[model samples]
Target chain A: MAIKHQQPDLVPLFIRYVGAVSSKLSRIHGIAGRDLEIKLGNDGVIVQIGINAEYSHKVVPDGERWTSEWGVTYEGMRGISQPVDHPLKEPDVSGYIWPDPHKPERMAEIKQAMARYHSDYAVMVDLSCTFLEAGYAHLRGMEKFMMDLHLSRDFACQVLDGLNTYYTALGVHAIEQGIDIIRIGDDIAGQNGMLVPPKLWRELVKPRMESMIHAFRKANPNIIVKYHSCGDFSAIIPDLIDLGVDFIGTMQPCGQQVDMAAIKAKYGDKLAFLGGLDTQQLLPNGSPEEVREAVKDVLRSYAPGGGYVFMPGHYVNLDVPLENVWALLSAVHDYRRYPLNFD
Target chain B: MEISTQDGERSMAEIMKSGTLEKLAQAVLEGAAEDAKRLTEKALSESLPPNTVLVEGLSAGMTVVGGLFRRNEMFIPEVLLSARAMRFGMEVLRPLLAETGAKPVGKVILGTVAGDLHDIGKDIVHMMLEGAGFQVFNLGINVEAHKFIEAFQEHKAPVIALSALLSTTMPQQKAVIEAFEKAGLRGEVKILIGGAPVTQEYADKIGADGFAPDAASAVLKAKELLGIS
Candidate 1:
């Protein structure tokens, strides 16, 4: 309903927690896994099943390194795995072996989540680190990948094509399984602006994404397409909307995104927003009272006439206090109602 | 043609009129590495001093790149290309600069804090500092506090720049500062901190001497910290 620009009973919540924060909350609730997410008041559950899962969601032990199916190596640090080595040293992808995305085991988690939570909650299938991020962060290192975009354009396109082919099949399969949202993302932006020039992103990444979204929509036209990036990607929001994205997320409050009121006013009619709360300072460093007030302020700014989902700009990392988490949740409940009244 | 103009006002005018150094600067501004390298070779073959080639050709181009970057006219990729072009020219000049005992503007140490593997920002700062004529000892990503101190001891660089991309790893910046404090060397050097999540407030909280938002400002801040005009 929010995506349709109608106010639901309350603003839907879709908060994500990092491994440590989730474990900490779970310990307090005496429950683990999905129940803990429910206890924390998440209106949705995300089952990430691609490079994003291996690179981000998988927890490895400290001081240990593991290589993923794509041959990228990651090191464990503070409850998250960081890619330490990329597979593609040079631009050539001819000898590279992509992990089979058609494997049946890949859909197991999504199937279980569908069975368990499909009736009551939104089930999103995250295929992020999907294109540019996978190219830069997983296959080729940032410097090499970025340089390749300029120096080795065809090779870069080959890598992106390989990713598009793999993920399009995987996403279509997920859509056939009737998932609520198909989340595709990349960290193509920094705090200030697009990491790649807008023209370059349009030339290299946009078409692949358009084809992927086309495949996804062909599978299920009703499936919600949510585009996510960590930082200010307002430059490409219109492009995303043109490509049929119904929702956009993690609208980090930085750069052009600092003025949430202006963004809401401009794109509210065409796009629904998720994740405007600041995670950098407020969630980690602010007082619980401050957190609540900020949450109310976010709701007041974004929740008018619907088209908003309440979430922190990024995953709640270990730095965030438990009290702030509680405050974020309670304040959402207090101010998330239709016709939000802060008074 | 033997050009013997190596003094002050007439020298710059003669060099500009010759267009060799100007072409080198334009090549860097355009990020044409081969052109930069070729022009650098030409300038050297013309019996131009390595310092003259560096200051007049490469550094002059980088100054324009930095200004354009600050004004948001050029983005990171373009800046990086320019940095790459500057490096190509430097590769030919470094040994010659050393032979002439031409000192860098100053020495500085740069690194991403411990547990932070993100180095794109730090790498940009590295090249920008080098482009600005600082001898930068870039301790690569996931650098521990001890490693930074060790590098500081070896290089005796008066300024250290630390980068942390994650809020999880951001505390390591404070940890690094604390390590320097414990080493009793905190007073000896100025520390500058930056990254995606870093701010002036965090820099102040962590006892950092300065904070920079991006690579261009980092150069200005490093110069300010070093009292380099």
Candidate 2:
């Protein structure tokens, strides 16, 4: 009902536990990432289509780096794959081959996911890291990418355009699979503010996002567009609303974006929000009672109208106390019903 | 060929008066790398000291960029551009200064704290610190507490900067601080912390010397910590 913009029986939850957290949670709960999320009563299930493996070149040994189809090589030491080399570092446009978005292997997992989970829970297709970030982080590396943005606007546009074209097709395919939400976006903002200037993002990323949403809507009229960014992006909330983003995730409440009530007051009617629990300081250091109180506060502030989902602001890291993690999940289950039972 | 000290100071004053320094600053503020590089070359040719090229010409420009970013007048991409433009000028001065053995303003060791892979903020702070004339040794993402201690010991840096974008990993800042104390290195160096979810209050609580919201402020805090202008 929340997805439909109507008040639901309770506030829904979306959990994105990744990497070290996933491994630890699996060990502690004796269940895997998705299974643990389901066991915790999440209303949605997200399955990553491992397109990276199929499109990637050869997988090296455990300690070696692996190159993707886009020619970005990533070292696996970090929790997430860190791009060490970009395919387009030389700005050699003629030799590069963009991956085939229509490849059958890429859509198989998404299809399988929709088949299994579409009936009981919300199925979200996460087509992530393909907006402006991949154009640089994967294709040209970050530092070089920024230099490219400053020095080579036309080439940068061409790179971002290629990504926009690919993701739109993938999004259209996901829509056909009868998913509830099609997730998009890369980490374009930082703790304090936008990583890309609003003007540059408006020029390069915003239009492409608008086009991608249009493509998704053209395919499925009722499908929700879920956009995710890692840091405080409240500076562009209005612009995101205008871009047809019906939902936002990992609202990592930092900086000026911490005022959840004000954000809900302004855009709650148009946008459904997910992930506001502080993950940096509170979840790891604060006590279980603090975690519980935070969960209550999040629901009180965001769950009032109709459109809000409960979850960690970002991927639950390994260092989060297991007690706080359980507190976060149980507190949501305990307090998220509406007419919210506030004691 | 080098200009005499008197001639260099006079040229710097002349450039400041003629608005050439402002143009250099404006080029960096606008993130025009070519213009920054060209202006630095011209300024050097006009017999300005390398130090003046660094402080007045390049650092002055990035300071404005940082101010705009703090006020939300500028965004990340523009900041990156400005930092890059400043890098172009620094590239000109780096080798020349290497031969002269001119000491850096201060030395710092920086990293994304243990268990956090987010490096964008750390990278920005690193670039901004370089432009500000600090000799920075960057310990890449997912840096452990001991690594910070080791780097501090190796470089004997006066300041240590830690970054974490994940709240879950933020406690590692305190842990890193604890490690410093256990190693008896806490008082030897001032610790500065930044990233999403890091606040000045948190810095105070963690016993860090200061906290900066962005790259520009990070440099200023480093300067303050080192008792340098």
Candidate 3:
């Protein structure tokens, strides 16, 4: 209902924690994973599939190095795996073998999550690092990939085409399975602005994304398309709307995104927002009272029109204190009640 | 001998009048690597000083790029291409510059600090610094404090730039500063820190010499720190 721009009993909530933070919370609450998410108050359950699931999110001991199915080597650090070695060292993808997307094991977790949580909660199939990020952060190194985009346009197109083909097939299958939302996440922006120029993104990544979205929509017209990027991608918000993105998230409140009320007022009619809380400074360093006040501020800014979901700008990393986490939850409970009362 | 010297001076004057150096600058500004290299070769063939080609041609072009970047008229990709053009010119002039003992504008030791693996921003800073004539020893990512100290001990570069992309890894900047202080080398160098989550306030808090928000400003900050005009 909130996604459709209508008021609900309360504003929808979907808070995510990194693996380390989740373990820390689990130790205290004696619960883990989806149950802990529900206990902490999340209206949705995210089941990440594909490369992000198989590699990036998988936690290992700090400094331990391993290679993914795609042959990208990563070193585990601070609960997240950072890609250390890219498989495609050069622009040529002809010699590279893409990981099989049709493997039955890829959908195992998605199936289990659907069977368990689909009845009560909104299930989101997260296909993050989907395009540009997959190319830069995983397949090819950042510098080489960026230069390829400029100096070797055809080779860059070949790389994006490979990713589009792989993810489109996987996403279509997930849509056919009746997931409520298909989140296509790419970190194509930085804290300042879009990492790639808006024109270049439109020329290269946008059409491929449109085709992926078109395929998914064809599979299930009712499926909501959510877009996620870590930084200030406000320049492409209108483009995302044109591409049929129903929800956008992690509105990181930096650069031009500092004004949450303005953002809500501008795009509230067309797009629902999932995150606006400042996780970098406020959540990690702010007092519990400050956390609560900020939560109320976010609720007041975004929850009034019913096109908002409450979450931090990014995952609640280990840096965030346990008290801040509780304060966030408690404040959301206090202020999330609809009909808009911040007085 | 006097006649040959006079004749060489006349030809050099004619070359300058014909705007060969201006063409090299334009090539770099346009990010046309082939044109930059060809123009550089033409300047060298005409017996222009290597430093003349570097300062008036390549660095002059980069100076404009830096200004446009600061004013938001240009962005990362365009600046990167400009940097690439500058590098192609530099590649042709490097051995000659070395043989002549022509010093860089300054020396810089740079890297992403310990526990921070992100290097795209740092790499951009590296290119911009080089375009400005700094001989930079980039130590790559996840560099420990001791490694920075070791590189400083070897290179004796007067400036050190640190980058940290995550708030969690930002403390490592302070650790590097403290490491220098402990090694009694704190007074010997200026430390300029930057990255996504970095700010002037944070730099002051961490006892850094300066802070720049972006790569373009990073070049300006380094020049300011080294007292380079």
TM-score of each: 0.97, 0.89, 0.95
Query: Candidate 3 residues A1-343, lDDT tens each?
Result: 8988898999999999988889999998999999899888999899888677777667788899999888989998767788999998777888988887888777888898899999999999999888888888888888778778889899999989988999999998888777899999788778877777889989999999999999999999989999999998999999999999999998998877889999999999999998999988898888999999999898888888798999999988888989999999999888899777766
> Candidate 1 lDDT, tens digit per residue, B121-192?
899889888888899999998899999899999999999999999888899999988999999999999999
Q: Is candidate 2 or candidate 3 better by lDDT?
A: 3
Better of 1 and 2 by DockQ: 1
For all candidates in order, the CA lDDT equals 0.89, 0.81, 0.88
Against the true two-chain complex, what DockQ does each candidate achieve?
0.63, 0.55, 0.52
Task: Give the distance in Å from residue B228's predicted Cα in candidate 2 to where it truly belongs.
Answer: 2.3
- lDDT for B88 (candidate 3): 93
Candidate 3 predicts chain B with a TM-score of 0.91
Compute the lDDT of residue B192 as modeled in candidate 2.
94
Off by over 4 Å in 1: B1-13, B16-18
CAPRI-style docking class of model 2 based on DockQ: medium
Clashes counted in candidate 3 amount to 0
Off by over 4 Å in 3: B1-18, B71-73
What's the candidate order when arranged by decreasing lDDT?
1, 3, 2
Residue pairs clashing in model 1 are none
- Report the lDDT tens digits of candidate 3 across residue range B67-143: 77665566666777888899899999999999999999999999999889999889888988887889999999999
What docking grade does candidate 3 earn?
A: medium
